[model samples]
Target: MATAIRRLLTAAVLLAAAAAAPARAGTLPPLVDVAWLEARLGDPALLILDVRGPLDGEDVVPFERAHIPGSVHTDYLKDGWRTTVEGVPFVLPPVDRLEVLLGDLGIDETRTVVVVPYGSTSTGFGTAARVYWTLRVLGHDAVTILDGGFLTWRADPARPVETGPSVPEPALFEAKPRLDWVVDTREVERALRDDAALLVDARPEDQYAGRTVKPGVQAAGHIPGALNLPESVFFVPGSGRLKPVRELAALVPGTVRGFAGPIITYCNTGHWAATLWFVMHELLGMEDVRLYDASMVGWAADPKRPVERAVPASG
Candidate 1:
């Protein structure tokens, strides 16, 4: 009982802080802000990636022409680091395919790749978060997301953006799944029953209520006992900055409600879940956080599983 109270108190404190704290407009680790990015524009070990995919715009090169200087181009929407999921559209690729793809992008275990998306939309950061989750799942921790995202950088014309692609020698990015970084459908099966795991759905309410399950998924509901906390909830609108830690506590109830030590975030395709990963793992300073890489598409596809459209019982 004491432990539960303590966790609840901790969560409350986090949320309060988040709500009260001043807005910090930027990314995690305090290293991805514009000042930081500006300072490291020419660093060798750091690799900048303009991952604005084939956006609905006028021309390709035209967009690339106005990117952050020294930033390389990669269609965050196109060049996927994944392959067949046996069923789903955005399933994670095999380890080998992922490694080869990263290598081709000139990314290796050593390079500190900073992803740049087109706008502050969750879509852009979602893409970056997905890649970040991939690296973490593959066992690399040197990754970081641009807090304010690409549009923030471009908003300032004085800032530099190169016109072409930047390529590097293929580097070996090894894969050693930190199973703890992610939880699969089977694990969710058990974790749902376990009081220790906080099942957080990073999707919006409509999806949680059995509306948008995405194509190919067998169901529209959510994992039984999961809470609907969309990934966008944590962000300070327009800025990539997350809500203050304390403030988030109020918005996101902690594991105190008979919940467990760590939190697991999930969405239909594992995309929005990555945003939650950034919020919980990096912003709120929660270490025992994991992203459901397979998410709902992987979970509901199996006929053996059952989903719940209503809010889980807190009692």
Candidate 2:
């Protein structure tokens, strides 16, 4: 009881601080709307990163053409943020490599970094979430995603944009790893039997049901007892923004209510699952959310691990 009360008090204090100073943002909550970002445009401590690029085509041409003023572009796909380890795709890179990557982009301990996705689709937005997760894992807490990303910024005529290259003055980046935010394949296996932890499959129903799959993953379906909640449901179709809170609350129904247990989110390679983790942990302020970085690619590769698909029961 004492521990519960202490946690509640800590959360209350955080809420109070968030309300008191909105400008000192980007740490606890991992999202910021365009309006908030527009107001803080010229702050010296702000680092805007445009992570817009195709997986395999073009340089930073799209980002070079026009971007938020003073914003630098990093190709999230090609960059070493996610790497292959012994044949697994989209796994987090080594800590030393990540520190240098962020340092080269002029990111440091003091800067409030806001990652901007292209915002074309829910899948596109996952890039921003992955980057946000990486920063948090590296122990840089002052990072958030531009909620609507570059599309919403471009929609408003008053928002200023700049073209051409931006050469950021590199800063030293140090990594203080937060091991709690991540869960490996072994931990996930344990969570399968632990009722206190909920295993959420963030892939679409087709993939979840073993009807379809993306390339490079060995599995056909999902882990046993995992619930399917596709990432697309979180975003509004035409608006290029997340649905309002009331609407978002209705989508998952009783799934999250009164459940203070840990949520472990995963997809084929941890890409799509990042979106669900962002919504549950960052947007909704759920305290215990962890991403399974190896995801199904790792889970399914081993024949000893169990996998499941939906099947009709006998009438």
lDDT of 1 by residue, 1-315 (tens): 998998777766676444432232223352266777888888878878666664323333345457777667666556775444666567677778877777777777677778765654665677777777787677766667676766777778888777665655667767777667767777777876665587888888888889666776689888887788887777677544555555555565645223546788889878888877766666555557887777887888786787887766554
Candidate 2 vs. true structure, TM-score:
0.86
lDDT of each: 0.69, 0.80
- List model 2 lDDT by residue over 1-315, tens digit each: 998995685556445434433332434356778988988999999999888778313332387788899998887877698898787778998899999999999999989898998777777688888898899888888988888888889888888999898788899999999878898888988877666588888998899989997787787888888888888898898443677654554555346533678889999889889988877776655668899999999899898899898832422
TM, every model: 0.82, 0.86
After superposing candidate 1 on the true structure, give the runs of residues whose Cα lies further than 4 Å from its correct spot. 1-31, 54-63, 193-196, 238-241, 244-250, 256-259, 312-315
Residue 295 error for model 1, in Å? 1.5
TM-score, cand. 1 vs. native: 0.82
Candidate 2 local Cα displacement, residue 25, angstroms: 6.2
Residue 188 of model 1: what lDDT? 79
